[model samples]
Target: MSAQFSLDNAQKDGNEPIWTVTQLNSRVGRLLEASFSRIWLRGEVSNFTQAASGHWYFSIKDERAAVRAVMFRGRAQAVGFVPRSGERFEFRVTVSLYEPRGDYQVQVDSMRRAGLGDLHEAFLRLKQKLEAEGLFDPERKRTPVQMPQRIGVVTSLAAAALRDVLTALQRRAPHVPVVVYPAPVQGADAPAALVEALQTAGQRAEVDTLLLVRGGGSLEDLWAFNDEALARAIAASPIPVICGVGHETDFTIADFVADLRAPTPTAAAELACRPRADCLQAVDAAFNALTLRQMRLLERASLRLDRARAGLVSPRQRLAQQAERLAALRQRLDQAAARSLERGVGRHATLAARLERCRPQVAQHQRRLTELGLSLQRTLEITLQQRRQKLAALTQMLEALGPNSVLERGYSLTRNAEGKIIKNGLDLKVGETLQIEFGRGSAQTQVLATHGLL
Candidate 1:
């Protein structure tokens, strides 16, 4: 009998213990969990699938074997990038067993691209070292030459990059001279050869700008440009260096340390030498502008000259015109004097008539003023007397309503300690504090006993 069948048989016989399929699977899962908590697995991924419930299923494989794996939605969402088939990665996972099928698998937690770890670490280390030494400071970078008189190239003569650069330079600035300092741009000896070429070019001082260029390639193929020695050499060169080592996305240590970085060798040449056609166009435009300005200036000068010529006159003519103006001014002054004399006489006669008319009115106004003054004095005296009488009546009314008047009439006022007037004796308790007011004085007292209630 099979083990499962025999276990059932034993359970029926009641001679030995038996385990169900569920129990067996549960025990195996517990054992797996107990034995292996978490592990790091390095492998290539394949057969990846994302379920509707957002769970990820895949297999990780190496040369010899493969194992199924899954990443639940929660953990998978934590990954920064999506995973694809056939990509190698290092995964942090937990060993697990699916109970229903009794299948072994790993639950992945996180992942990172494989093979890049060591290279990335090394790249970072060198970058940090150079940056700490101030090799990448903006202040240390040399200013790029605007239009170089001569450009020296440091690259392999066999490289396509060389042809691209030469073609660009020929097309852009044929007037500028180019010197090729041939050097290997790949393999083991490239860094050393490049350094030697740069040093030689520096010593010669035949070029104002230097271009270090190479075609695009894989990171490993372009590793020579990442060399620390190469970077330092580029930084130390007296001639401004423009590095175009790879495509736009590829960055190397030389790119950081060089005076300027271009996307490709052709671009570097274009930068170092401006286009001849563009220069000619600019010169033409400037000449046309200057010519127009000169023409406008000449026209303005001519207009001014014409105006000046038109205004020219003899000294005698100017003197005759001034004499005419002086005669007119003298006539106007004489006319004004005569009119002033006539107006003064007329004003004196009018004033005499007005004085005669106003004399009688003035006397009549004086009599009316005297009458008003007497009336005002009588009214003020009567008002003063009436005010005195009203004040006396008001004083008498106030005295009748005042508490002092009541006190003077043989009545005493009682107030509590809080200054509240007491209206009835029954409102007070024995030993309560009170104040008694009389006409002339006041006294503090205590309620010794109760009185009759109203």
Candidate 2:
């Protein structure tokens, strides 16, 4: 006989179950994935491990329960920071069952550090929203009353922060009056109560300044002060607000929107009220400063007056000195003028004497000139007679030495046909032409024969 067995999500093949453990786990994974598509879970990390494959395996747990989780390498790379043991974190994940061990686990998609969780994220979002709207602008923050006559406080009456602010104001400024507007300082309703208290104090307008005070706590505990509506109300308040929420290290939206932010509740009160003794001391210092400045100015003026007095001179004395100098100059001028006139007179007399001595003797010069002319005439006549006698003697001598004169004395002159004188008979050639001249006439002849003069 054949028996049929039943199994979950198993297909029957001819009365035999065909589903493997792996197939079962895969179907369960698909169902879980479809049931919870993406889920956010917040818990602390434990038993964390990073495999050589770069995949992360860890367990996330709250105080009571824990779940196994795995982040693949590709998704883990985008997580921005590494997951560590014992760190509180939040993640969005999908559920799946590992087929090998039938273990249920989650596949993490993304994660973040959960130091303050959603409250911190909400706080940042609201802060950024208000900042973009210019609510946190430094220029819009009003200056608080340095010395307020009446101080308004917004806080829980049961809170220790209220007592602290009152004690500080009493110690610093006992004369200043205190008005309290009580409100819850935590939980969901706290933000609206705080905003209403701010409105009430602003409407009254009796308080010179308003103080928003609260004690220090974690980000979640102080989140009420980070409310968006409360921040706007504080910014719109007619009186300037001093915010003293949380500790020195803590900050909230109210602190940023308030005109002044103190480190503590007592500090906020002290800031609004100045001590009487300190005020008196400041007034005294100002008065002393003014008096000192006035004295310095007066001393400078007195020194100027003294300097002017020392530089003073009498007008009459100056005029008398100028007159004496003028008289001396006039005496020198008179001496120079007299000396110039005497020199002029001497020069005129000298020029006149020289003119008289320079007169010309015209008659004597003419007689002497006439005597020189007669002597020159006599000497010229005598020289001319002597020259004539000498010239006649030279003419006679010249005539006596003439060749015609020699020819006239019974001598003859002979010449060749070329007119050359024939000095010797040898100079004539036979049958050559010659000419002979007596003192009175001349004849041509032929050298028919030669004769010796010897």
Candidate 3:
């Protein structure tokens, strides 16, 4: 007799020695397929090979666990991506049992640079979303000032990062004021806190610009900077925002969208300060340049004054020329006075004789009187005729041409369908339609006859 047997999912789980080879293989294969399909494993590559059929076979193992993975030719070709040996990555895998071989393995679907690795997966997802929206475009970023009068900082006041910024600003340029707004640098509430502090600094009239900063840590540690709201706020800030979120290699959305980005809080502080040394040097150079320029200007002005004095003309000579012109003008006047005396006397005699011969005043007066009489007579006749017989004649002509007058004269005025009076009888044929109007009534009629003028 067979002893009672039970099989678990493990190697000894089944009591199926009586089963056929093909049937056992099919059952085992299906079991392996369903088991492997849902696994996600992180591993280092080992014994990786690509067959001539374009299928990839590899073993994934670390210190603790080892698994066989097969990436089929179809899946392999679609990946367009190949991972080399010794590279550590997480792959989405599917397990399937091959019926013929009765073997089990995983199939890789797709992968990226381990996007979900210790980094904030959600943060990376948001980053890619905003990046595609072009918020991270370099063109949108404004250049930070080489020297700022007042540096505005939005960060936790209690954090060491704030003290580091203050120290660096003091070291570089102690004269410039530092405006600090307390903000939450990390956690669920950090994003809102950072945005408010940024807005506060921007709202202040005294603040020259902004520094959105936090100390370095894990990706999740500095996630406040990656907040979409904070990124958009920094981008829209009236003051330029210089982001100093974390270490050099660490990237955040704020770093990309800010007006400027620094690798650390201290670097951002150094960037914002207008150093005493640079200022002193610039002042000295300016003074020297100004002194040289002033000397040249003074010399040029002195030379101009000297040349003007040497070339100056005397007022007495100008007055003498005017006196000579007056003397010549007086002599010409005397000569003209003598000629006028002789010419005036002769002109007086000639005028006296001409006035007697021509009597122009009498002739002009008579011609005016004659013109007045003829104009009055013509106007009077025209006005009388227009008020009497001519007005009656125009009235009679209007009455005779009236449509009712012609219709009442025993002649019917025929019009076309458009109500336009027919002027020529030939305008309508016998079969064409016509509208005939008598004195009191109108009727539609067909053109029955045609006639021509003799």
Which prediction has the highest TM-score against the true structure? 3
Estimated TM-score for each candidate: 0.45, 0.43, 0.48
190: Cα error in model 3, Å? 1.0
Which lDDT tens digits does candidate 2 get at residues 102-184? 89899999998886434566778988999999998999998887778799999999999999999988888888899999999
Residue 260 of model 3: what lDDT? 82
lDDT of all predictions: 0.88, 0.88, 0.80
Return the clash pairs for model 1, or none: none
Candidate 2: residue 454 Cα off by (Å): 81
Query: Candidate 1 on 1-454: residue-level lDDT in tens?
Result: 1233334434555466777888778777777776777888998877889999989999998768999999999999989777766567999988888999989999998988886433445677998999999999989988777778889999999999999999999888998999999999988899999999999999999999999999997665688898989999999998999999889998889998899999999899988976899888889999999999999999999999999999999999999999999999999999999999999999999999999887767788999999999999999999999999999999999999898888899899899999999998889999999999999899999989997855
Model 1 ranges off by over 4 Å: 1-121, 127-146, 156-164, 179-208, 215-222, 233-240, 246-251, 313-410, 415-420, 424-454
Of candidates 3 and 1, the better by TM-score: 3
Residue 179 alpha-carbon offset, candidate 1, angstroms: 4.6
Worst 10 residues of 1 by lDDT: 1-10
